[model samples]
Target: MLQQSSAALASVFDRASEDYDRTGAAFFTPLGRRLVEKARVEPGSSVLDVGCGSGACLFPAALATGPKGRVVGIDLAPGMVGRARRAAESQRLGNVSVQLMDAFRPEFHGARFDFVLSSMVLVWLPDSAEVLERYRPLLNPGGRFAFCNPRLTGQDGIPFVPEIFGTVMESVGVHPKTFFEDLDNGWLGAPDAALLKAGYTGIEVCDETYSLELLSGEDWVRWSWSHGFRSFWERVPQARLGELEKEVAEGIDLLRDSDGVIRIPGTVRYVSAST
Candidate 1:
């Protein structure tokens, strides 16, 4: 119910599996670490990283759980899970394993986790509430579940001028519905107070915002194309895509400081609950 081009987005990530994991430093950005930290992993704890991506969430879980413990990463995308498996094997991380599994209908026997962590994935799922319900059975007593998903901020975004994306989209004449709106309608949150209604305890909810320092016009352009403007661009004329890119880059340049760094603000909602 939330994502519009989820299938395409999944494919894009799947295609970038290797690049996604190998860029360890960039992969586990401060934002990712913040999400991982919420799990409160301990030595000997058994962890499950749902929608683990390549290894962004998996490796961190492994480190937190330690040799005495173990981490199992799973993703609905087979390619992502496969990439995670390879990385674990390459790093000789005997305590870690990855599996291809559905985020909403994870196939596991009994309550098995000390902690479960998910980032960004929940916001894109159509049945996020049901997803949480499915996960509830997997969390053992005293186990916790934590997740991070962006909160839409209704702010005026970059104005399009002439850029790669704009040019391409203009040529083809495509426009995708792009807007930052409150997370609701099951994908983000539910009126039922789903978490509490589902019987989670010690629920802690927090707001987290990430203000990025865009290093270059290219970085800003790429970031916007991959994020907020993504769905919009897909609907834009193919030729206008480039023009939009140029426009976004130009907007970013105007925001850049003398040091050539442009900062943009973003926000997400984080929550951690225990059973």
Candidate 2:
């Protein structure tokens, strides 16, 4: 099941690789930078970034660590890793390297890192506690691990666009399975206790709400197709995919503000812990 899930996510991300950053950087890049800042990385530190898509956190981390430090990035999609490697080389960042690897089962032995970081990756795992426990042993003594991912808020749950998309799919009698439909595999709760259970100390967790504005509702649909909500839409049959897309775009336009910019709602949970 783990392998299958990883492969599924990889396929979606791989397809989005070329325009992933261009389409969604307005929303994703800031969060990645924040996770790096929260990690408190310093010069000469060894950092590991899981699910380091397009080197968002990875590049900033490399810059933070400077010439004396090393930053390694890994992702399930080869396309993403390739893009990161290209970016690193183009910038002449000798201290950075990237690999295509599964975050759930990292291919490393011993506590080789001073800091481990992830952004919006844990929520996709089948077992957050087990995965956190596995990551604990990879951090050196007193090392820190930090991550940021969305945590659904209140009874409303999810963002406006995804909720509308899911409702449309059901309305069409598609009944496609979606990650948001199962919070266990797609969402996280208060994580400090889970970190404590995983043998981490100095744990801190915080939540913040953010708003994203697309040039228009069509841009929102394009962004959604490349980012967090892609997986849910992929489950729709190819024959019905066009219809679903149209319905989602029309639904989003209805919520646009007077300025003609579509405001999408989001909330992120940030966690930092020490070994």
Top candidate on lDDT is: 2
Q: Which ten residues in a row have the lowest lDDT in candidate 1?
A: 156-165
- Reference-based lDDT, residue 260, model 1: 63
lDDT of 1 by residue, 1-275 (tens): 13545466566556555555342223234655677787678888999888888777778788888898988888776678887888899999999998877677789877489889997677656557766678878888899889887665334232222234344444455532132233433445432277877788888887766666666666755554443344555565666657766766665577767876666655667788888
The local distance difference test score of each candidate is: 0.66, 0.79
Candidate 1 shows a clash count of 43
Off-target runs (Cα >4 Å) in candidate 2 are 1-4, 160-162, 173-178, 184-187
Candidate with best TM-score: 2
Alpha-carbon shift of residue 162 in model 2 (angstroms): 5.0
- For every model shown, the clashing-pair count is 43, 0
lDDT by residue for model 2 over 92-174, one digit each (tens)?
99999999998988888664899999988887666666788888888989999999887666555564444576677777554
* All candidates: TM-score: 0.81, 0.91
